[model samples]
Target: MAFPLKFTLVTALLLLAACRSDPIQFHTLTPAQVGDHSRTTVGVIQIESISVPPQVDRAQIVIRQGNSGLAILETEWWGATLVDELNSALADQLSNYPAQSGYSVRVDVQRFDSVPGQYALMDVKWRLRSAGESEPARVICRSTLQTPSGPSIDELVLAQQNNIKRLAALISQAAARKQAGCLMPVN
Candidate 1:
């Protein structure tokens, strides 16, 4: 009886372990090295924004398809919904590159009012300046996913989130490079 009980316990433990899934994997990125803590106030900066039309219903990527090279059952992942993920990512990325002198940066739907001499004109526009230039005068930036096949909603969200993050980095870098003294990067 003791032996049977021990075997059952071991089997149950093993089954439980097998049923558990591994954590989703992702790559790590280190923030760039920029020196100093300073403060600069940006007055009424116009955020020229553009959004890549959402491709919500259409599958941007396909996974686990059958041998037809890329054909299989289609599934939608949750994360690829739309703006929420992008906005979060963009905010995170831009947080590091703050406008002069450690001033608090604000972004919103309403156009900011410039106080002539007090506010400096910062045009945040979006344009294909180069292969991957961040929008020049846009506050919020957007891009559409180029899905390979039908991806699960989770996968879509992850992929889109990652893309937004990457774009944020690129845009920040571009802004830092272009605007002489506009934004000061985090040390």
Candidate 2:
């Protein structure tokens, strides 16, 4: 009787342990902290539309394994779809920029890659159109931003946030101009 009772308790304890799992962690691309600066802008500078690659648009955080492989982390997720999170982050940062005039910006991401212990990269083709300007007056430009990362997913996320913030800065600076020139490279 004693042995049977001990066996039942051990089995129950094992089952309980098996039921536990690693908690899922959600992350966002938004600024980690709000700044002291005002959130209002002088003129309208809206991010008209931004498109991300379909491959990376999922809720799970997908990372590069090597040159040709990718890994989707089930326990790591974005707060929302990747595209929505990215747009929100950019909009939040761009809303504080002072524009010479109203401008609408559009970005189409060509590549977005995150590698643990490596780097985060964003290559995008962006266009800025002056408010009330025709399509022919718009100037399209491209920028590729890369940030170094440490060995952890958190570091990769931070690197990607930096990349997005840099992209927003580039957009804000280029939107201030109405010429038909491309954006200058940023170091």
Candidate 3:
């Protein structure tokens, strides 16, 4: 009986320690707001590469009537916290372009149906990966620059800003491609 009890207690302690370990999470880079040729320009669209979750394990203990004890039980979890963090960072960075660039470039946060006369909802897909051996991560990011046939000047400005942001990020990634180590944009 004593042996079994001790085994259970030890198992519980180990499990607790594992649970208390700090969780790993990724961080995002700041967006660059600058002016260029009278048009608002984004110096860089810095995005971190998506990260994988750490492994987790749980321990369990079992006791036998014969006064023997056994500890056996481990589990793992696949969390998407990293993904959520990236998504939030991207959305936040994209949404702030208009104000940061003096509204010279527009940053639209609304959704609608069609493009121009046939207005439709816009779809966005963003992907990021390491470029060979570069210092910056390369990203394949896209967004539908949509508006009514005659979008207001503000709307058009926002669209251009959005495109510029995407372009800056992509160009940075491309230049950074061919090396691995650096994961964020420089300058």
What C-alpha lDDT do the candidate models reach, one value each?
Answer: 0.35, 0.83, 0.34
Which of the predicted structures, 2 or 3, would earn the higher lDDT when compared with the native?
Answer: 2
Model 2 residue 59 CA deviation (Å) reads 0.8
Model 3 alpha-carbon drift over 4 Å, by segment: 17-22, 31-103, 108-187
Stretches off by above 4 angstroms in model 1 are: 1-50, 54-81, 99-152, 178-187
Residue 148, candidate 1: C-alpha displacement in angstroms: 9.0
lDDT by residue (1-187, candidate 3, tens digit) is 9999999999999999888854432222223456442433353233443332221111111111122432221221112342443344444454444221111111222221212222222334444443224433234444443333333323322333343345344334443455422233222
lDDT (Cα, tens digit) per residue for candidate 2, span 53-103? 888889999999878998989999999989898889888778767677788
How many clashes in each candidate?
A: 30, 0, 15
- Could you tell me the TM-score of candidate 3? 0.22
The window of 10 residues in a row where model 1 has the poorest summed lDDT is: 112-121
How many clashing residue pairs, candidate 1?
A: 30
Query: For candidate 2, what's the RMSD?
Result: 1.9
